[model samples]
Target chain A: MIHPSAKIGKNVVLGQSVVIEENAEIGDDAEIGHHVIIKKDTKIGNRVKVGDLSVLGKTTSKNKKMARKPGAALTPLVIEDDVRIGCNTVLYRNLLLKQGAFVGDLSSIREKVTVGEDSIIGRNVIVETNTVIGSRVTVQTGCYVTADMIIEDDVFLGPCVSTSNDKYMGEGNYPYQGPIIKKGAKVGNNATLLPGITIGEKAIIGAGATVTKDVEAGKTAVGNPARVIK
Target chain B: MIHPSAKIGKNVVLGQSVVIEENAEIGDDAEIGHHVIIKKDTKIGNRVKVGDLSVLGKTTSKNKKMARKPGAALTPLVIEDDVRIGCNTVLYRNLLLKQGAFVGDLSSIREKVTVGEDSIIGRNVIVETNTVIGSRVTVQTGCYVTADMIIEDDVFLGPCVSTSNDKYMGEGNYPYQGPIIKKGAKVGNNATLLPGITIGEKAIIGAGATVTKDVEAGKTAVGNPARVIK
Candidate 1:
């Protein structure tokens, strides 16, 4: 059932059993495939395409305790014009995707995250809450982005790159801090980053490296406890 | 559509557009989410909760020769009572989950596997074929379990733990033999286990450690090419 409060624009096509919740707005020339769920207060701009079984604007609070934190209302999601969301992706509440952004299949983007214009999130990528991804960034498949991350413009993260937040593994009081990938930097596949480290501009991290510290600008880091080289 | 020959018990809650194939049986008080697919001859027990978009009873055969070995009919999946299966998890055929087992969100359990009673398989975990997990095993999120593993009781694997059965990485004639994790052992997050190694009883593998050899019983192993530290 399409709710009465939903505002669907002209030339929009919705496939079989798609659910558009109350107060959701879809702009002109949008295509929503089968079994997609557009939750309440979501706004989709013109010429957007959402693939099959993708869910938009679901509420995410990390855990039950955080969800029950006082004064937490459901946040709104915004997707600008010319965006493409692939199959089975889940974008949580407070997500903002600028124009020309692309999100691939089976990805999960958490709450309060923004994908700047023309960014690309590949298949099976998981971006947690409060992460800011800047324009023209590319995060490849199977990469895990922890919460509170900052990926600046034109950065490239290879497939299966895993980042962590807590070094102590809940044993002690360790503040959660995600990695910082600066502009034009590139991280190779299967590289692991420890908490709170900074990858400087144009830095390169080799495959299978375990980065335990910050990588300086214009340098290359490789091997375990990654050191600067080349 | 639920198949006519399928047996659904009392007080079962099925969401919109769930598909239950022929001869599938769902026990009492089970909650099946939207777009979930339960294939033929699969048996689910009482009070089970299957989250949205999860697919049950598909078949997987990783070995090319075994998959080409003909005369294999569709295998069956058996889930005992009071189990909780999270969102988007996929369980292949020839699988068995004991009573009170909990499977977290987005996990993929391949064929011919048995998870013991009261065990917890965390989110995004991939347990390949022919794996046997003992009771009360805790495998945390994003861990990758290779084919043909034996995990004993009371074993705790932290998040992002990776295990492999083929050390040559599909290059040499490395015979497939997965790691043997003994009883009461603990493996910290991001630890990589090489092929065929035995982690002894009560052994502790530290976080980010790479296990390249057998770990002695009750010892603590840490670092790449993991050596006994304590």
Candidate 2:
């Protein structure tokens, strides 16, 4: 079911029962699988392979807390060229995926998150709201990138890695503080980065380690509360 | 692109470009949306609304080290009568959704997960393999129920809640050590339930609480390591 207002470019192969909502723009040579939903005001890039049961442009966070009363600004989601989005992936509104980014199956990328060019997000990765992942990064399966973290370029995040942003976890507080991961860092599988900490460039965080403080550049850290290993 | 071997019952309303693979069975009065994919060995129940881009009978966790090998067992997905599956939802092989079960938009239910009768799985919820959810349960938005968890009847799971079964998570390590959530339990938003912990019957888990131990029945748990509040 394609709306009359939906802008579909030439040679776009749409499989059975696809729904293209109003004002959605699909670029040329994009392959959309069956039963996919492209919601309103969404724009899909060229040569993109949108797998089955995938939903794009749904706004996940629309509450009274996010409302600016009447004349507030609303952001749009932009997916750049040659991206491959796997089956059942959900890309909410106000997000941007740069060129050649790959999101594996069953991933949930929340609002305002940006995956930079050529980054690979593996299966079941939950990237929370407003997190920025830089270019050529590899976030492995089951990683949880919590809100407001900055993951710089050339970082490698292993499976089930988790990061938090709030120090007191916003307990009884409204605005929460976030964390950052600098460029060229590597976080191993199941590693936990506590809130408000930063990982410097070229640092290595071992598997299942918990980082409670800032990690220096080119160092390796491990264990709970993470002492510097190198 | 419905295969000739597919069995479509009477009064089925097939939307534009829907694909029903070989041996797939569509029950009476099922409404399939455009571009939906009903892969092989899938059984759709009567009066079901399979939304656009929704995929049924796709692959599950057989490729993972924690799961059974591929071709060790293969079973069809059985979606019972009166189910309303929203757009971009994926039901992999061996899944069973009982009558009146409603899976909201962008949800992914992996292999062998059973949603009991009248259960409502909210938007973007992820149910990993082999989980058994009881009747009339409400799993809210953005929650992740990892593999092999038992959620009893009438449980209420809030947004972004997570349950872990694996204490030591890795390849060849089956992370299914988490305790069951007894009947009528209510887990609030963004709560984390660590491995090997049980939430007793009628227990209330507070928002953003990190639960590391067992919660007694009919109690309210809050804070990190989740002490009983009431």
Candidate 3:
């Protein structure tokens, strides 16, 4: 069901059973796949492609058990020109995907997040709320980018990387702060970055490493407790 | 669309937009949620509860880049009595979920896998092809259980754990064999178990540990390369 208030531009192709809510806008040459759901106030720019079963501008659920409460006054979700979203992906309200960004299948991007231009979020990746990802970044499959994280331009995060925001695992009173991955840094597969650490520019973290502290710029860190090897 | 050959027993409740393919069998008192797809020849036992947007008996995809090729002669997926499947989960063909098993939201269980009775496969978890998980096992959220793995009864795996089956990461000709997690074992959060290792019964693996070798029964292992600490 396409709402009467929804705006669809010329030459746009919509598949079977697609739902466009009130005030949602789809630009020219955009293609929406089967069973895709676009919530109210979503803005999709020109030449955008959304795969089957994707949900855009979804609202976050708040429960009593949740440690972090989501913001109430979220704005409309914005997807700039040439953005591509794969099947079964979920993008929350107040999120912004810059031009030419690609989000692969089964991913979940939370609210207030900004993904810069030309970035790639691979399959099954989870980008939590309040994170900012810069341009030309590549986050591979099955990774967890915690809330309040900062990933600069040209950063490459390998598959299954785990980043933590809470040091006390919901037991302590400390503030939640995820890692800061600087520009051009590369994190290897299955690596774990503890809370509040900063990976300097062009630094390398080896596979299966458990990083406990800040890494120096242009250095390589390996093994548990991740000391600089170079 | 429910196929003419499909059999829905007494007291079955099917939600809107559901698709039940040819020869599918749904037993008595079964409750199927919205937008669910039950493929051909799939068998759902008595009192089973399936949540929204789930796909059962899905076929596997094979490509040239894939290291492991799926079996050709796959059979129908079978879900035993009282099994509960959460929202957006996908279960492949040739799979079996025994009585009372719970599969959480957004999880993917591949073909030829068997999950025994009363086990819990948590949210966003990935259980690759050909893995057998025994009864009462707890695999927490965001963990990756690689292909060809064996997990015994009462095992506990924490969130974001990673288990690998390929030692060479698709480069070498070595046979793929994931870790064997024995009965009552406990693996903590963000732990990485390397290929082919055996975690013995009642063993405890610490958080963020990189396990390179086998862990003995009744022991505790921690840190990178995971030495026995107890």
- DockQ for all models: 0.20, 0.12, 0.13
Native contacts matched by each model: 0.03, 0.17, 0.11
What TM-score do all the candidates reach, one by one? Answer: 0.84, 0.65, 0.71
**CA error at residue B198 for candidate 1, angstroms:** 2.2
lDDT of 2 by residue, A30-73 (tens): 88876678998888899887877678887665576652233234
Q: Which ten residues in a row are the worst by lDDT in model 1 chain B?
A: B62-71
Per-residue lDDT value at A95 in model 2: 87
Q: Write the per-residue lDDT of candidate 3 for residues B160-182, one digit (tens) a residue.
A: 88877766443448898889999
The 0-to-1 C-alpha lDDT of every candidate, in the order given, reads 0.85, 0.80, 0.88
- Clash number by candidate, in order: 0, 18, 0
Pairs in clash, predicted candidate 3 = none
Tell me model 2's lDDT, rounded to 2 decimals. 0.80
By TM-score, the candidates rank as: 1, 3, 2
Instruction: By DockQ, rank the candidates, best first.
Output: 1, 3, 2
